[model samples]
Target: MASISFWTTGNSGGSLTVRSTAGLRGLVEAAGFTEVEDAESPAEGRQVSDFAESGPRSMVDLVRGTGAPAVLVSFLDSDVGFVEAVTPGGGTWEALLNRAVADDYGIPLDRFPVEPAVKEALAWAAAAGLTPDEDLLLQALTGSAAFAEELSSLLLVALGLPDPS
Candidate 1:
């Protein structure tokens, strides 16, 4: 009954939440990890004050406290850099994007209308001195299978699980 929680940033400012949980579960199963359905929204009943004070840390703590793994998926923006502070170092949004585009991952960048949005987001992150990548951004825009698999693998590694499939 192992579980993982997926959280995405950059949705509060009119951006969309990247709903990749289903895809992640499939990839995890394909990779030989047990899959657990998230039957409820983890954010349910969370106080605004809790989120306001702790931000993504609260979500991580909540998920981990439930005896499950937590995966924070961040969209590119100035505030998105906060993911680096909460998670282990060097797991930058940019690094995730690069991995998604690498061999085997093969994100079809041209298949989705993600270029315009990603360009805007990258510019925003750069302006804030953050080197955010476009992988999650593309996923948020298109939810392509390649991006989904890339994201699932990233989360699996972050959760200290094997990702061979």
Candidate 2:
């Protein structure tokens, strides 16, 4: 069994405790989703901290070092499972991030990073696989015509898909 915990970051507001894998699965179960992973041999060293850094290997290093099977379930871009899971058959990262920002912060994408908002949103969304490409930060700040396209493209390229099949 692999355990996980989620931490949320906010602009000025700081961090919030989200949930642990045990808690998440319990929620999922409560919501009618079955727990699929065996809890007997859970992944070790579960640290539900603030989120990973902004690079490819750094992300892998952080996740792998956590000893989480969710890491294996979360690999993106270079990982074939992520590609195949998210490519044509899955949800969109942009949609998830937009929803998160709108639903959680009451802020639109254009209004993000209103002063350290980037640190919170980027790190938060990126960690959640809701916004993957670090490259999005540049175009988003510019509000360029390419912003939408680049964001979408980055969302497509960088998201980590959940492949249960």
Candidate 3:
């Protein structure tokens, strides 16, 4: 089974713990990735949280330091950013996401689907008076418990894994 570690940004309230987090964990598991609790020390299974104050580079470093395939899910109100940690065999996550968007929505990488998605989602959230948190954006998009599942499914399809319902 392929292993994938998940990390999230912008958890201000100490609420979005990746391991026991409500929405993402189930989706990741459903997508068939064996979740590695501690990518830094795989055997230790330690819980890790990258603070918003640490910036994106810290998250990038954390992901790269893992030496294994990993996904860093950022919840900030940016252009639907998906970055890949440089691992031995895995290709760029940006390329993967672009291709997935192209395949699913016919929006090529050059067109940049993430920007529009983020814009639309944020606009909807703002109109609804929702906070621009990860959970809200995710819930706005996938209706709770489906964000990671949906994203993982897209990524799995990009990686040629069997699509999970």
Candidate 4:
């Protein structure tokens, strides 16, 4: 069985969307994906404030432990279409994420999606017609654990929508 993961860019375009997260999770489940937690990040010693840093850690760890093939819902920040090969060791961060995209998103050698995800996330962030950058993207991406902190931004897009990036 494959352990499928949907890695969102948090709030694409600067809007928080929980429904979007749920939508993707639902799709992954429909695709027969079992939710596997990731690994914990190396602590740097500070106030444990952000859930984004920790939430995915457990999931990452679980996937590594299971040795299950993964499908990453690609929220790629760039334009490389990386289809993954799940090797025996199969424990590298990039490998696991690539597998999640390739195995789950079904990346092809010839055709691949654009990087840096100019998807709805970006659109949502561009409310008031303001352009968002990578720094803003990271902040919006981590604003919440399961939803965008701001809801009005994603009035059109659902939180759990599939990766259109």
Candidate 5:
């Protein structure tokens, strides 16, 4: 199966500004990742980590630098799955799949509200010339589909991201 964890924000309309290999390099570099490189599948619209080298703090900084809403999906392993969305207005929301693991580890899953993130995604969709239903965004952000990568792919398509395959 094709699967990986990464963050993606919308692209400028009708352009590859933020969804192409070059674009991702630029975005990450702009976000202060000095030694950025294409992900294993650059067409997947993700840049491999400076986050791993620099720490999670770098990832947080990268998202904040976007100045726009962004979504992150992590499904690197069977026992761990996470999704997060951040709005331009500063709202952040997340869902933890693999609840069983979270329970086992005693991790708190609910950290913020979902509605605001959905609203932000809607607003972003409008700005990007895409129109996905609110319920779809809601479900995508919060649903427990069998696989996190599957859900991530669905959300990307719904938000009108180019099919990275």
Candidate 6:
């Protein structure tokens, strides 16, 4: 429950591996986010007033810019959530907490992963060269109709993203 939307890059002992803030800015801007600003608390992280206009592309560019796995998680009132990730080798994955809620918001369900892709989590871990909790990762990928905050937290841990808090 950090924020409605946020980007997190892979970290080594809490240190980010993103090449530089400028590179990150370029990626974010390319993804259709304008006026990107660095988050004061999280080093090498950025926050937007709302979710990115091009979420999946933004995530892909994040991995490309950081040269490591990257994650983007967004929630609405902690009731519905969406999470997307991309590995360094171009592997991409995502999941949605509540497809119905997303559709209600006029957000296209097809744009997000509505079905289960638990195996992709393992693939992401392997590509990232890290061992994550299998059970937690699977559950995160499975997603639930409620408790979007929990889903977001699970994704953060499953992908080995640092906890800004």
> Can you give the TM-score per candidate against the true fold?
0.24, 0.23, 0.30, 0.20, 0.53, 0.59
Model 6, runs deviating above 4 Å: 1-27, 34-37, 40-52, 98-116, 143-147
Off by over 4 Å in 3: 1-54, 76-85, 88-91, 95-149, 157-165
lDDT of 4 by residue, 1-165 (tens): 122124333312111111121223333233332442222222221000112211234333323433332223223332111212121233221211222333343444123232333243344334312344544433332222222223112221232222222
On lDDT, the stronger of 1 and 4 is 1
Most accurate candidate by lDDT? 6
lDDT of 5 at 40: 36
**Model 6 lDDT per residue over 31-116, tens place:** 55444554323444432223323433556666666576755555556556666667777777666655565667675655555344
Can you write out model 3's per-residue Cα lDDT over 1-165, one digit (the tens) per residue?
Answer: 111112224322111112222233333333332322322221133222322322334323433344333334333222232333222243322311223322343333453334444444344334323344544333323322223334533432232222333
TM-score of 1: 0.24
Query: How do the residues 11-37 of candidate 2 rate in per-residue lDDT, one tens digit apiece?
Result: 111101121344333322232222223
- lDDT winner, 3 or 4: 3
Deviation from native of the Cα of residue 93 in model 1, angstroms: 10
TM-score of 3: 0.30
Count of backbone collisions in candidate 4: 35
Q: Write the per-residue lDDT of candidate 5 for residues 97-160, one digit (tens) a residue.
A: 4454544545454442466656656766665455667766666666655555555555656566
- Candidate 6 has its poorest 10 consecutive residues by lDDT at 7-16
Clashes of each: 1, 3, 0, 35, 0, 0
| Candidate 4 wrongly placed segments (more than 4 Å) | 1-9, 12-54, 76-88, 91-165
Q: lDDT tens digits, residues 1-165, model 1?
A: 111112232222111111123433333223232222322322322111101112324333433333222333333321221122122221223223333332233433332234554564455444333455466455443333333334433332332223312
Whole-model Cα lDDT of every candidate shown, in order:
0.30, 0.27, 0.31, 0.27, 0.47, 0.53
RMSD of each: 15.5, 15.0, 15.2, 15.9, 8.6, 8.1
Q: Is candidate 1 or candidate 3 better by lDDT?
A: 3
By how many angstroms RMSD does model 6 differ from the true structure?
A: 8.1
Instruction: Please identify model 5 stretches exceeding 4 Å from their true place.
Output: 1-23, 29-70, 76-80, 84-105
